[model samples]
Target: MRVTMIGTGYVGLVSGACFADFGHVVTCVDKDPSKIERLERGEIPIFEPGLDDLVAKNVKAGRLSFTLDGAEAIRDAEVVFIAVGTPTRRGDGHADLSYVYAAAEEIASLIDGFTVVVTKSTVPVGTGDEVEAIMRRVRPDGEFAVVSNPEFLREGAAIEDFKRPDRVVIGTEDPRARAVMGELYRPLSLSDFPVVYTARRTSELIKYAGNAFLAMKITFINEMADLCEKVGADVQQVAKGIGLDGRIGSKFLHAGPGYGGSCFPKDTIALVRTAQQYGAPVRLIETTVEVNDARKKVMAKRVEAVIGDLAGKTIGILGLTFKPNTDDMRDSPSLDIIPALQAMGAKVKAFDPEGMREAAHLFTDLELVDGPYEVAQGADALVLLTEWDQFRALDLAQIKNRMNQPVLIDLRNIYKPAEARAAGFLYSSIGRA
Candidate 1:
């Protein structure tokens, strides 16, 4: 199949590259000249693992290409995917669908024959209808089927998730459209990955519902961590006790600062607003959003409890990205926690293997250092913010000696309490007696 993907952002780039690797001719289109230029020159703009190699391999095989203008690609393609960003609107908290709608209009004008237009970006329910309406308004006689195909790829492990998805939910009632989508995902279907065909609205809701549930799960564990702290219990054991049941399982149960990334924060808020607009409300999700927001800010106080006075204190931060292996800083816990510490008269120095370049723009007065040891040097306290792989097995004794005062606040609970304490440092962690 010949596929034209509009808007070469994270979703577009990754999906286009993967589709090309599946032996489809893919042309990724972006309005940004520099982004398209970078892709053409074998330079990947994002830091996803194995993505550069995948893109390079497919491009060398003449199956993947990049373009600034997608007119020719759209006219010749059998499938045109609107993989643009649907970020939250400023005040309304609704998904900003302008980019998706604009892509529909452009695709409507250029598509020559039968085309299956797929929405690969995470969007609110009924967006497919609106996109169809917009395309019809632009070209009334165009023969195109608008389908909803929301992406569920994680940031750090997108390629693996794309290749071996738990399931593929494709939304379409049109037989021709379903056939095209099926052929597009034939590789996965052949490998026994389930492809669920559903109504467009249901497919859209599935993405939001799945994300909201995961966000709520994280919040539940975080709340449990607080209760465990008060009751002299360990939250890790609590998670283990509950997770042993096959029904509950164990994912997103780690007690950390909070849930933060591109999807959860924005999608939960969008779902809440969408539900209210439709004369129904999800109160649990509303509470999940509220608690997760408060959790991030409250983490700074945990450090204060150990150090006593924050006035003129220097704190070392371990990680800055929301999670490791990706440079995305959107809604990261460090964004909330670091500023709170600074407001309380603490100076902060931080290090992350990949996130520092992007973190520099989101933070002010934050000292980005060379390495984890550099962050530890002369600091009054060390806060392990994000649990990068490198930070897991640091020389605890060496870090203890380098700090002005030996203090370790393990937010992610990456270190054993006894081991940290035995290293001759004042140690504090989440949800343990």
Candidate 2:
């Protein structure tokens, strides 16, 4: 199938590349000249594992291309995919659908024949209807089917998720649109992957409901971690015991600072606002949002308690990005933790394998260092904010030697308490005594 993918961000770029890899002719269109130029030169603008190789392989085979000329791409395309960002609107927490609607209007003017216009961006329910309405208003004679096909790609493991998705949800009753979608995802369809066909509204709600549940799960475990800390119990054992039940399989059960990323924070808020607007409020999700926002700030206090007086103290941080393997700093716990520590008079030095370049602009006064040891040097305590694999096997003795005082706060719970204590450090971890 010939596909035109609009908005070459994470979802658009990954999906376009993967579709191209599956033998479809794909043109990824972005309004940003620099982004399109970068993609054209084989330089990907984002950090996702295996994406560059996939894009390169598809481009070499003449299946994938990048361009700023969206009209040209849409004119020759059988399917147009809007994978633009639906970020939360300022003040209202509603999904800002201006980009998606604008893309639909522009696509309406350019599509030559019958085209399946798909929404691959995570959006509020009823967005497909609005897109369809906009297309009709812009081009009365145009024939197009608006289908909701929300993406479920994780940042670090997007390519793998795209290829081996748990299930593919295609929201469209239009037979032609369904057939086109089926053909587009035929590569995955050949496997055991299940493709669910539902009404457009249900499909859109599924994306938000799914993210809200996962966010709630993470918040539940985090709250359990707090209870475990007070009751002198281990949350890890509790998670393992509960996770053993087949009904509640262990996925996002790890107790950490909180859930923070592109999807969960924004999606949960958007869902809450959407549900309330429809006269059915989700109070649990509202609480989840509140708990998570407070959790990040409380994490800083945990660090403060571990490191006596923060006045004139230096603290070393191991990770910056919300999670490792991707350089996305949106809503990362470090964004909250670092500034809170600084406000308490502790100078901060941090190291992240990939997040520093982006983190630099967020914190100008922050001392971004060369490596872990450099961050450890002259620091009173070390905190593991994100669970990067490299930080898991660091030389403990070297960290102790470099630090002014040996205090280790493992927020991600990556280290054993015995091991850190034995290494001559005052060790503290989440939900473990």
Candidate 3:
């Protein structure tokens, strides 16, 4: 299949590259000249594990290409995917669909023959109908089927997820569109991955509902961690004991600062706004959003409880990205916790293998050092914000000797309490008494 993907952002780029690797001819289009130029020059604009090599391999095989103008590509393609960003709208909290609508209009004008237009971006329910209406308004006689096909790719492991998805949800009633989508994902279908064909609205709701549930799960475990701490219990063992049950398998059960990333924060708020607009509210999700926000704000107080006074103290931060393998800093917990520590009069020096470049733009007066040991040197306390693989097995004794005070606050609970205590350091962790 010949496919044209609009927007070349994280979703667009990753999906387009993966589709090209599946032996489809793909042209990724973007309005930004710099982004297209960078892609064309073999320089990836984002930090995703193995994405650079995947893009390079597919491009070398003549299956993937990048462009600024998509007119010719759209006219020749059998499938046109709108993979643009649907960020949360300001004030309204609904998904901002201007970019999706704009792409639909452009595709409507350029498509020559019958085309299957798929919305691969995470969007609110009923967005497919609005996109179809917009396309019809632009080209009344155009023979195109607008379908909803939301992506569920995780940032760090997008390629693996795309290749071996838990399930593929395709939303369309048109037989031709269904056939086209089926052929597009034939590789997965052949590998026995379930492809669910459902109504467009249901498909859209599935994306939001899935994300909201995961966010709730993370929040639930976090609340349990708090209770465990007060009641002299360990959250890790608690998570392990319950996770062995088949009904509630352990996935997002780790107790951390909170859930913060591109999807959960924006999607949960959008779902709340959508439900209220329909006269049906999800109070649990509303509470989840509230609790997660409050959790990130008070994480600095945990440090204060240990060190007594943060005034004129130097703190060392281990990680800055939301997760380890991706350099995405959107709504990361560090964004909240770092500033709160600074406001309480503690200067912070941080290090992350991949996130420092992006983190530099989000923080001010932040000392971004070259290595973890540099962050530990002369610091009053060492805090592990994100559990990068390198930070897991650091020389605890060396770090203890380098710091002004041998204090370790493991926010992600990466270290065992007894080990830190035996290393002659004042240790504190989440949900372990």
In candidate 1, clashing pairs total 0
* RMSD after CA superposition, every candidate: 0.7, 0.7, 0.6
Candidate 1, residue 197: the lDDT equals 100
Candidate 1 collision pairs: none
- Report the C-alpha displacement of residue 147, candidate 2, in angstroms: 0.2
Q: Give each model a TM-score.
A: 0.99, 0.99, 0.99
Off by over 4 Å in 1: none
Q: Candidate 1 lDDT, tens digit per residue, 139-164?
A: 99999999999899999999999999
Clashing pairs in 3: none
Clashes of each: 0, 0, 0
Q: Runs in model 2 with CA error above 4 Å?
A: none
